[model samples]
Target: MSNRGRDTRTARSRWSLFGPIVAVGTALAVIPLWLDHSGVLMGVAVLGLAFACYAIGFNVIFGSTGQLFLCVGALAGIGGYGGAILADTVGLPVVVSILLATLVSCVTGGLLSLIAVYRSLGVIFTGIITLIFTLTFDALLLGLGSLTGGENGFLIKAGADTFLRKRIPPYYVMLALVVAFLLLHGLLRRSHVGWAWRALRDDELAAELAGIDVARYRVYGALVGAAMLGLAGATYAFTEGRVSPTTFGFAQVDVVVLVMLAFGGIGTLLGPVLGAATFTIVDEILIEFGQLRLVIYGALVLLLFLFLRRGVIPTARDFVAKRRLSQASAAPD
Candidate 1:
């Protein structure tokens, strides 16, 4: 194909891919306005947004940086606990506690990354270590009963404002947070640090040779990702008005992090948002089926994986790009 033709085809393909996203965003913004239970609907929308944030954070480390982390739930719990503890025990404002939780989660991520890098562990080993850390943290929380409230969990005090108590307030806060975190993702993806992360994912030794400081970049990615997770956790706790160690168990972590990533297409930016929305809707609606819901959900996910190997967005983008390339090649000289 001629260069001109190829460029035109590529431009068209990019526009085609982005068009759907714009349409979807329009729908999301408009739908809430018309819903009968606007508050509940908005709350669900906010929860989906929160999940998207958490998934994107995971994407940075696991998808972009090629790290295997399994303590997603534990880290989120740490964030929630940190926020709740500060809000309740130390009398910090909810907003301050939430910010503090994010910082703490960053610290936690840094410590975990340090251990991973220092040990020179492979992916599987890192996964195992993370799993161990998650389990140990759960045990510690259970043992620390007084602080964590053990299995019973801790209660969060609602904000003083009456309007803040309404479900819509939480939804708005979460939506704002999701937007902020996602904006950060977009900025980071275009930055030097983001490219370094992709390079590290491509080849650690080569990235090291290129003076990318692979370990530092990896740690930074982890910290950034953890910050997002922490924000999600803190927001979730505040919105729910409570938190428990049980909330961050292995299953919840695996389901939210892995399932959402798988559904969203890990490498691409839109995958998490799309995946979280679809998964949340599916989960919510399927609850009516009782015992069969889980079975059906698992089956659907398996089928999706089998057919859409790269998850939804990646697979679609690949398809679009390939088609555009073909069209370019077939164009008249």
Candidate 2:
């Protein structure tokens, strides 16, 4: 094909990827208009957006490079607590605190990746180490009760007087972040870096042999992903007006994020958002279940692992492909 033909094809390809992004974003944009009358439902929608951010970040690290950093909640906790402490206690600007906290989380995530790479840890081992780190972080929070406010937690006094204190503004803010994250993921998926990630995720040794720096790329993914996670966490602290040990605990955040990523189809863009939205609505419905919510979630995870292991996107894509092949085979010669 001529260069112009190639250019045309590339442009079309780019549109194929980004068109859905714009549509999804536009659809999400109108959500507030629909739920404006109900504060509780709007709040749930915002929480879903937050979980979408978390699942996206995790997808970058684990779905892209197979790092399996299981400290999702712990990392977010760092950002939330750091922002809360700096803005509320240290009297720093809220923006500055959130940025600083994101940096800290980014650095921490990078270091964890480096450790895993240097130690030659496999996915399971990396998860184990990160889980230990998560537990350690929880303990440290309690140990430093004076600062973290211990079991009681502390309110983000700095944000109390801000727009975030209201329901509608925070939803838009979170929606903006989620849309931005989707675009960022799309751009990365179209880049050479994305090729490296796919290669590494498929076969790390082959990727390394092909001149990709596995360690460097993994660290880069972790850094970008962790920064997004931290920013979401920090901003949520201000929006929710509080930070607690339970806020980012493994049971509260990590499990939900993991389930979302799995259900939406790991490694696929928009999977996080789909999964988060689905589960968030389900959660609201199950609110009447009380503690049985966890049991139901556990059952859903089990069913997913047993039946839909490939997740919604991949499974649906495969089904469509198979149907097309069958139709083509059945056509007259």
Best by lDDT: 2
Per-residue lDDT of candidate 1, residues 26-81 (tens digit): 55655566653766666667667777778888887788777788888888888889
Which ten contiguous residues of candidate 2 have the minimum total lDDT? 1-10
| Colliding residue pairs in candidate 2 | none
Best by TM-score: 2
Which runs of model 2 end up more than 4 angstroms from their true locations? 1-4
Candidate 1: clashing residue pairs, number: 0
For each candidate, the alpha-carbon lDDT, in order, equals 0.79, 0.91
User: lDDT, candidate 1, residue 310?
Assistant: 86
User: Measured by TM-score, how close is model 2 to the native structure?
Assistant: 0.96
lDDT of 1: 0.79
